[model samples]
Target: LPHRYPFLLIDRIIELDIPNLKVKALKNVTVNEEFFNGHFPEYPVMPGVLIIEAMAQAGAYLMIKKLKAEGADGDFTVLFAGIDSAKFRKPVRPGDQIIFEIEGLNIKKSMGKIKGVAKVDGQVVCEAVLMAALKKS
Candidate 1:
């Protein structure tokens, strides 16, 4: 995912369906997270932006995998171009495992749009429509 520890949000890819343009990924939040220390010392909560970022990563994975399956070869990087209709439904905390479901809405050339939903314990924590661009790196 081109991301390293502390910044990489996704822990695993549970599902990948290139034909369907969908992907599911997981992120395990822990008390040791660097953001928890400052987000709230008294009562820590996962930042909403990070949840969205997790979803974006999952979408990026889907796009990259799809591109590879199509035999397009390159060192590519996906960058967020925009986010729309983002909503935070619940607060995430340490020990919570987040599941990100991403479905491609549109993909043309180097640009793509996806609908992302973040869930914890089967309950939605956040949802957003993400736009991204793929560029050779």
Candidate 2:
């Protein structure tokens, strides 16, 4: 978590549905964000890639949390194995509350699959299918 900088993407995780292996997190976007300066000077807009990254981070957090709950110790890293069928449906601007939701599809010994979505004010902003794997520390 400390590794994140320039304002963390995740503000808080509201729900963790263990039975379904799903998680819900939030990110508050503001106009003063640094990325807006270069992304566009006149027509500032949040980058689409960042939206996907935010979703991916939420998914990673869930995987790490589950691993920790299962009594896994030491430093274990979860890496993004692949991104499939990612789509940016709408532009996410400042002053938006992005609700990120991720569901665990399959979790094996080291690899896992998750379906993630980012919503702004109850509207879908982005969605993606992510595959991740745990790496040896």
lDDT of 2 at 43: 83
Candidate 1: what lDDT?
0.93
CA lDDT of each prediction against the hidden true structure: 0.93, 0.84
* Candidate 1 stretches greater than 4 Å from native: none
- Tens digit of lDDT per residue, candidate 1, span 40-128? 99999999999998899999989888888888888789999999999999999999999999999997559989999999999999999
Give the per-residue lDDT digits (tens) of candidate 2, residues 53-137.
7887888778877777778786667787999999998888888899999998886559889999999888999999999888757
Error of 1 at 13 (Å): 0.2
CA lDDT of 67 in candidate 1? 84
